[model samples]
Target: MEKLILTRLNVLGHPGRMAVFRLLMRRLPDAVPAGEIGQALAIKPSTLSVYLSALCGAGLIGQRREGTSILYSARAQAGGEIVDFLFNDCCRGRPETCAPVSRVFREGFPDMSDRKYNVLFICTGNSARSIFAETILRDQAGERFDVYSAGTRPYSQLDPFALEVLKAKGHDISGLRAKNVSEFCAPDAPQMDFVFTVCDQAANEECPAWEGQPVSAHWGMPDPVKAEGTDAQKSLAFQQAYGALRNRILSFTALPLDSLDRISLQKAVDDIARETPEVTT
Candidate 1:
C-alpha cells in the first residue's frame, strides 16, 4: 500500500506532470485528447508525452483511443485510495478528529424537501447535451426540481440518438423537443434557481438576464451531435453524454439546499463543473 502511494506521489512530484494530472481531473469523466491538453496547458507535444506516460505508468490516469484521437482521464479509484490513506493516517481511527474535513466532503446541503427548486439547462443546439441533462434531472428528482432546457439557437428537432439512448434507459421521451432561450425569458416563464450552460458556445454567449439572479455555472462537454463515425459510435457519444449528465445531475440534486448560504451554494454548484466525479457504469 505504501509503495503504491509512493508511486503516485513520485509521478505527481514533477510540476509539468502535476499540471497534466490536474487538467485531467478538472475535465473528469471526459476523456480529453492529448493535443487538446497540450494546447490548454501550453506544453510541447514531446514533453507532454513523457508526462502522460508517467501518469499512465503510475496508474494515475487512463487512456483510450476514440476515432483518431487518444483520450485521457484521471483514474478516480486510484485518487480515492491515495486520499483515503492520507486521511486515515492523519486521524488514526479517531473519526472525531477529522470532523472538519468530513463536513467539506459531505458538502452539507441544507434539507429543503418541502419546496421544489427550478433548474434550467442551456446549450447552443439544445438537441443533445442539454436535453440529456434536463431529462435526467427531471427523472432523478422531479419531485424536488422543476427542470427545463433551452437552446440559444434552437434546432428544429431533437437528435435521434439522444432520444434513443434516454428511451433505452427507460426514461420517458414524450413531450421532449427543442425550444428557444426566449421562451424562458418571457414575462410569465418559470423563475429559475439554477441555470447551467452545458456547451462552450452557450457559456460564452450573452444570456438574457434571468428573473431571480439564478446561480449559474458552465458544465460544458463535447457536442455529441457533431460526433462523426458509424451509427453505433455516434450513438455511443450520446450514451456517454447521458451517463456524464446523469452523474452530475444526481450529485447536484443530492445536495442539501436548505443548509447552504448563497455564497456557499454558488461555490458548491461551481465545484460540480470543476470536479467531475467518477461516473459508474
Candidate 2:
C-alpha cells in the first residue's frame, strides 16, 4: 500500500481543482454532471474534466453512472480532511493566541447569557440552502442556538429535495414552510443576534438593515435547486448543501465566544468565516 502525501495530492492543489472540489463538497452525496460544472464555472469541458479527474484521483470525490451520464460527489470521510487541510495553519505557530476563543466552548453552550443567539438565514428563494441551514443547525446545535430561515422573496413551498434531505437526516419539517424575510423585519419581529445571507443575490441586494444591528455574515452557497439534471441528480445537490451547512455550523458552535470582548468576538467570527469550507452546489 502507498501512503498519501500532500505533494501527491498537489494535483488537487490548483485553484481550478480546488474550485471543483469546493463545489463537490457543497453538494456531497449527490453526483453532479460534468456539463453542469463546466457551464456554471464557464470552464471548457476538457479543462473541467482534468480538474474533476484530479479530485477523483485524490480520493476526495466519488463517481457513479446513471444511463449515459456520470455524476460526482464528495467522499464523506475524505471531505472533512479537505476542509481541515484548508484551515490547518490558522493562528500560525502560536496557537495559544486562539486560547480566548477556545475557552468559550469549553465552558459549554448556553454561555451567551442572553437568550440563545438568534440566527436567521436569508436567500432570494427560501426553498434551498437557507431552509437547509435552518433545519440542520437546529438539530445539531440543540437548544444552544435559536435558528430561523427566510427568503428575501420566498417561493410558495419548500424545495422537495431540501425537504427530503432534512427528513432523511431525521429532522422534522412537517410544519416548515418558505417565508419572506419581511416577516422578520416587521415591527413586531423578534430581535436577531446574527443574520446570514446564503445566496449571492440576497447578499448583494439592498434591503432594510436589521434593527438590532445583528452581526451580519455572507455564507453564500450555490443554488441547489437551480442544478440541471434528473430528480436524483438534483437531490444530490441538496445533500451537498446540507453537508456544507453542517460543517459551517459545527465550526460556529465550537467557537469559544463567551469570554471574549466584542473586538475579540468579532475576530473569532471572522476566523470562523475564513475557516468555513467552500462548497460548490
Candidate 3:
C-alpha cells in the first residue's frame, strides 16, 4: 500500500500528468477521446502519451480502443480511494470536520449530472398522498430523480380525487399508479436512493426490506380524501393537500442534494415534511 501510494504521488507530481488527470477526473465515467483530450489541453501527441501512460500505469486512469480512437477516462473508484486515504486517518472520529467528498466532485464531475437518484414515496393506502408525492417529484425532478410510490397494503387503484386534484392543477397523471411496497422490496428491484414514508400510518408500518437501505424519512400529511363533507368542502380538502404538498415539494427540490451529505440531506427532508403549513379546507 505504501509503495502504491508513492507510485500515485510520483505519477501526480508531473505538471503535464496532473493537467491530464484533472481533465479526465472532471469528465469521469464518460470516456473522452485521446485526440480530443490532447487537443483541448494543447498537449503534443508525444507529451500526451507520456502523461496518459504515467496516469494509466498508476491506476489513475483507464483507456479502451473505440474503433480508431482511444477513449480515456478517470478511474472514479481510484480517485475516491486517494481522497479517502488522505482524510480517513484524521476524520475517523471527528466526522463534523470532514468535508463532503461528493460535493467536492459534484460540479466538476459530469457523471454527477448524469446520475439519477431513485426516490420512493410510501403510505398505507398508496391512494392519495403517496401518489401525489411520486408524481410531484417525478415531474419536478424527473431529470434528477426516478420517483415511484408504493404502499404496504396498496389500494386496487388510485384515489379518484387525487387524480382530479392533480389534473385540475395541470399535473400529468398518466403514469400514476398505486403499487405495492412488496414490488419494490424484491432483490431484483432497482435500488432506491431515498425513501419517504408519506403518511403517519405507513411511517409506523413494518415495511419489507428495501433494496439499498435508502436514506429513509417520514413526511406525514393528513389524508385529504378522508374528509367527509359537502362537495365544495371535499374539493377544498384535496386542494389544500395539493397546496401543502406543493409548498413542501418545492422546498425539498430547492435543496442542494448533491452538495449535502446524507445526514444533512436527511435532516433537510425531515424538516420540510414537518413544516405543515396551516392549510384550510
| lDDT, candidates in the order shown | 0.81, 0.72, 0.74
Which stretches of model 2 miss by more than 4 angstroms?
Answer: 1-111, 279-281
Number of the predicted model whose lDDT against the real structure is largest: 1
Instruction: Give all TM-scores, in the order shown.
Output: 0.61, 0.58, 0.59
Once superposed on the true structure, which residue ranges of model 3 sit more than 4 Å away at CA? 1-113, 276-281
Q: Report the C-alpha displacement of residue 220, candidate 3, in angstroms.
A: 0.5
Tens digits of per-residue lDDT, candidate 2, 113-159, equal 86688989889899989988898788888587888999988999888
Q: Report the alpha-carbon TM-score of model 1 versus the true structure.
A: 0.61
User: In model 3, which range of ten residues has the least summed lDDT?
Assistant: 102-111
The local lDDT score (0 to 100) that residue 143 gets in candidate 3 is 85
| lDDT, candidate 2, at 244 | 82
Per-residue lDDT of model 3, residues 82-193, tens digit only? 6666556556634455655434432231234767988888888998888888888877889888888898788898888888888987898887787988888777787887
Candidate 1 clashes between residue pairs 3 or more apart in a chain or in different chains = 109-256, 110-256, 110-259
Candidate 1 all-Cα RMSD:
9.9
**Winning candidate number (TM-score):** 1
**Cα lDDT of model 1 overall?**
0.81
lDDT of 1 by residue, 50-106 (tens): 999999999999999988889998886787777677678867745578765554343
